[model samples]
Target: MGKSDAFKALIIGGSVGGLAAAHELRSIGAEVAVYERSVGRTQARGAGIVMQPEVEALLANLGLSARSVSVELRERQQLHIRGKAERYRAPQLMTAWDALYRALREPLDDVCYRLDSSLRHVRVEGHDVTAEFPDGHVAQGNFLVGADGIGSATRRLLDATSRPAYAGYVAWRGLEPESAVPEDLLDLLSGRFTFFESSGMQMLCYLVPGANGELEEGSRRVNWVWYVNLAEHDLPRLLAGRSGRQFEHFLPPGELRPEIVEEVTEQADASLAPQFAELVRLSDVFMQPVFDLPPGRILANHAALVGDAAGTVRPHTASGTSKAFGDAAGLAAAMEGWTPRHGLPLRRLEEWEAQRLSHLVRVSEIGIELATRSSLGVPQGDKFFASD
Candidate 1:
């Protein structure tokens, strides 16, 4: 049999990382299928991302045009603790999570992607991998990939020892249309990436396309994030839903309690500048408790972990998407270099393990530093600390 016909891959998760992995594996001549848990479309957080190089390369590989989907910011403005704004000449391509999702999803074949399917368990028989689904169906393949996000059931099965530990803070994210807010506010936020950092807290904002990927001037939306420290004991109170159940992951809009939301708004008004605080107060808000994942190898059995399922660097690194792209690229390269009987996935996995471990260390460190940057510190010497 030809290499193309020799193996099949079953992928868990259909977000960006999973989709990218599907595309890359298919290109390397493996039969590929993706399994996602949601019945409807993915409800992304609508947050903005600084498109790192790895993501750009993935887009180029698919021959997709990003101009219609992304916004290019020519400079960065940091609101210093001294009550002054400093503009840096760092340019970046920024896009919403939903926009990037659609751009990447459009190019993938619909036939191979499965929604409303979740992994219940996996059975490995020598080199063969079979995934058991909650719906009582089974899919067997030569390779299996777990691209599920941080709450990954795959990570639970493969690497049970590593749990997502709270990182002492949470990110409050919001997005609003340009027309929905005041004109002066839009002018202040448009055309540049802006950040406000104070006593270990940070607020960052940028512009991105509107709902359904609309990218016109006034049609676009503004995306912002506020990173605030919350004591560990108080997290459950904020995560309490309408049903009163405390959640550890993300909280949907309806589940957000009125009292907690009101309290957060009051805190914003008190702590943030009036203009910036108004921006947070006026917009819809949600919470994501930050977590730290120390780096590790993703390969195990004939199955591998792809994207966030593998490891998650803090959002401060801005390398979350880029790291996922690199994982997909590295897997494709290893598969392409395969030689029947002579192929040693173990050796290849070892090489990838070392490379990604080192990569995540550098990335996570930079993220920690940025998240904790203080005005009391030395002048920003190396801009590398601010890179993706």
Candidate 2:
């Protein structure tokens, strides 16, 4: 491709991040293609997500909106064992990972979306970059984006030394069907983002759309997360499911190891409030180890990284999706600035990198601070997102 050729942006990974990238690039009149490793639908267990403005803005920009797939929340509460509680009332939007994915992925044309296509590597030669597939299919584009998430192959190829480190805590997460939620407990969790915290541990639950994206009362699901400090050495055994197969990614339901479940149950019973313990006992749970990825070397050799592939944020900041949305917006702006007058637009790319890295640093720093504050019985504070 010549310097004056039409812009062709190849996006790796077709999840929320990559699809968002495609949407932004297409808006700028760039040729876009998304290569996703997963063949069909993809979902994460314990997938309740708190939506942010940036994500909502992107959806608006793409002329797409979440449909029948989210529950609007009105308050945040911290319940005490003595039955007293403190409430922080604010309008919040929560949805499932599946809902967010559907809202973002359904808009793109299928012809340019290559499912079951995994990016094995990328070779940058002169003004163009070539993406190699495992099946030997090669795609050439003017620039490349790595949005394949935390275990990103593009990140590996782009910065060979990047590694995701364990964050010293594991979140035991699950969803309780409104049907399964106890008659008494339903009222407490239904309309609010509720949390219960103890020294070195915290538990929170709030209502979200049901599996079918139902929003009616008694049909919505209550999503819960319990954070505990689990040593890194024990992770290997925990990764093995009842089938004895140690999966690399987060374990899906039924595949969670019985021992880990038992451990969580015991911990909940011993350390958690009675109602919370029962919630833990009845719900099928999944585990995710937290990690802090310092922003480093995201832009290099005609490519950039987005979303978790860029760097993951601890959920405490409630900025994971926002960060991804910001990356997509930044990339769109950078590409649009690449005119003949500016040539390669290297300065825009660098400015984009600086802005994104600063945001990641702020979120990650708050996440680390949250660990210290969890012992104080509040995982996050009002000034949380405001500080950065």
Candidate 3:
């Protein structure tokens, strides 16, 4: 690698973290390309995300307006089963994953993003890296980033031993359009973050931008997530899709077996607060088992891992998106002032890894503590990802 060589970055995983990295690196004049495994845009994945400064910075850097895609939130309330509510002032911004995705990707041309490009192999030669795809396509760049997420193939190249550990619980999630929400339900859920906590179960709901990032009153969505405790042995059964094949990550909409849906519906009606029970009953739902990945090395040769690829902190931390953006910002900053380098800047990469790994360790601990405190069935020694 010569000082005059343009910094060409190959980013794996086209989700929030990877796209954020592309924008940040591009702002620094780096040529970047992103590869996503999904054949089409992931319009339905992910739910509500609490606004963080890092997200705002990423959007602004990309020349996109965050407010155009976000909703202002004013308070947090605990909704009791008896319909009583406990409220507190907690101002924040909330956005949907799809809205942010559309905003970040709006500026990038198709040439820079490859859909359906699943990574099969990665080869590192000095400061240069090459990514091989299953369809016989190969991409080479000055550097490689494993922003592909928790199951990142690039992370395997860095440290194969680390994997996402199950958190002994699964989150049942749904989104209901404001237009479709009953006026009473909207009255209770609109403009505020509401929670319902009980023994081994927790539910929360908030408003997020609606279709095509619409922020109007009638176009917004009521996003809810219900975390339910599940014994480890019962996880596979719940993760099994309609095809009878078990999924390791999540059960997307319409994938849950009919019986499973019935069981959850019954549980919601019996155990959840009246408002939440109605919300769950009225909307189609999906399930994602919570998982935590203990911090580990995030770099291998010239390749670096970011976002969930580095470590997956439980959702209670509310730091997943922030952590992804933080990782992107840190990496971009590390590579910012480097003049033409002869080889990979091993020391700088190490510094970024140290900072990020430290942050991940702290966040992971917080998630565990919060989940345990919530009585979500997380037992001692059950914090690591189990490899089948």
| Best-matching candidate per lDDT | 3
Model 1: clashing residue pairs?
none
For 302-322, candidate 2 gives per-residue lDDT tens digits of: 889999999988777777877
Candidate 3 Cα errors over 4 Å, as ranges: 1-4, 339-341, 380-388
> Over the full model, what C-alpha lDDT does candidate 2 score relative to the true structure?
0.78
lDDT measured at residue 361 in model 2 versus the true structure, 0 to 100: 86
Candidate achieving the largest TM-score: 3
- lDDT at 61, model 1: 76
**Predicted candidate 2: what Cα RMSD to the true structure?**
5.4
- Clashing pairs for model 2 are none
**TM-score-based ranking, best first?**
3, 1, 2
Q: Model 1: per-residue lDDT, tens digit, 191-266?
A: 8898886664678899998888887888999898888776666777778887778787787555777777787788
lDDT of 1 at 153: 82
What's the residue-level lDDT of 288 in candidate 3?
Answer: 90
